[model samples]
Target: MVVGSDGYPLPMARFFPNLAIALSRETFARIDAAETVTNLLSA
Candidate 1:
């Protein structure tokens, strides 16, 4: 979760839904790619 200057969670979904969605998608994509690579190398 993104933190605000006030030390609270940023209302990203409410104020910047597009950005929030994009960030989540990118994060998941990276994680999935990393996992795939790790599995391939382990095998």
Candidate 2:
């Protein structure tokens, strides 16, 4: 389901933890090891 799916990992979050969130927005989610917005969920 990723455009550039080969650009990141997949263990960063519980894939589709909620159908509402997964399909609500444009679903701009991805896993980058550069430490980007990884902590946004906790904040």
Per-candidate Cα RMSD to the true structure, in Å, reads 6.9, 15.2
How does each model score on lDDT? 0.90, 0.52
Tell me model 1's lDDT, rounded to 2 decimals.
0.90
Q: Report the C-alpha lDDT of model 1 over 1-43, residue by residue, as the tens digit.
A: 8898799897657678899889899999999999999999999
What's the TM-score of each model vs. the native? 0.62, 0.18
- Number of the top-ranking candidate, with TM-score as the measure: 1
The window of 10 residues in a row where model 2 has the poorest summed lDDT is 26-35
Per-residue lDDT of candidate 2, residues 1-43 (tens digit)? 3333687656533565576676544344444433456667656
Candidate 1 regions exceeding 4 Å error are 1-15
Clashing residue pairs in candidate 1 (N, C-alpha, C atoms within 3 angstroms): none
